[model samples]
Target: MPSSVPSFAELLNQCERSAIHLELRDCYASTERFEAWKRGERIDWEDRESWWHPYDQLIAETVARGVSVRRARIVSEPVSEYIRWEHYVTHANVTAGEEVRWLPRRQATSISLPGNDFWLFDGALLRVHHFSGDGVVVEDEITADPETVKLCSAAFEAVWERALPHHLYTI
Candidate 1:
């Protein structure tokens, strides 16, 4: 961990070849959009402007530049409300050119995973996300340590190899 951590956008901007994110949480704090969805506020799927956001734009641009961006989530099922919502909106990630996958916790019993969620950039830099018990992000720790990078990279690849693609994963 370093004293200074770059923002997610900065890390992504610096990413050249590939980036992978591994999420181990079953749920996260609800955002406004998530709360609205819980209230039965549905987004028109056909309307790109209605659902596409700045993050999506950034992802699109990054993908257009030929960088491969992938995300894998290790979730416990029968899923929580937040996980269900996340699955529902995952198309946004696909639309933005990210390949997303989901792995059931039961299936991951034998895999060695890190204590925190993380984004590994080009198999070199890492941005580890620390979160509270309730799944709220507390802080991000940045590191370039070889051992840390190796662990996270292996963990992500192990999950990705076993996880189901978003289109095939059903909540």
Candidate 2:
């Protein structure tokens, strides 16, 4: 039987052991915030209730349930403006209980990585993200292919091991 694909939120909710994400992009076209950052508007981390309404609650609750959430990113050395903004805003992720790490592209040259970004849930399911050339999200794929899962697991571990934690990674 073909398995039904679950939403990202569902994947997180159902995660028992861990929810690990590997991002191989320098920038994502998350419009509103990108524009806000471009305009020199920063996220007021002090105003948590306003900005963290639902997303943060979800992550916090999931973490409370004992699910380990981690995100690893592969970025270029001289990062894009988006990365700078993202680095600044990552405090929200940490506040929400996610562990994030940054790995420079130069450090990953020899690693065999998947072609797309992915979230591995409990080391069993893989949800791959496809992005357009300009960095807009296009689609997400969910799979349980054993070989692919093994590859992603190995690649993510390699990058995660070498990557710097969010606080120490400066753009």
Top candidate (lDDT)? 1
Best prediction by TM-score: 1
State the lDDT at 67 in candidate 1: 91
Q: What digit string (tens of lDDT, one per residue) describes model 1 on residues 2-92?
A: 5477778888988899989999998898799999999999889899999999999999999998899999999999999999999989989
Give the clashing pairs for model 1: none
Candidate 2 structure quality by residue, lDDT tens digits, 1-171 = 554677778888888989899999888877887798799887777888767857778889999999999999999979988888888888888999999999999999999999999999999999998899988877888999999999999999999999999989976
TM-score of each: 0.97, 0.94
Clashes of each: 0, 0
The runs of at least 3 residues in candidate 1 whose Cα sits more than 4 Å from the true structure, single-residue gaps closed, are 1-3
Worst 10 residues of 2 by lDDT: 1-10
Candidate 2, lDDT over the whole model: 0.90
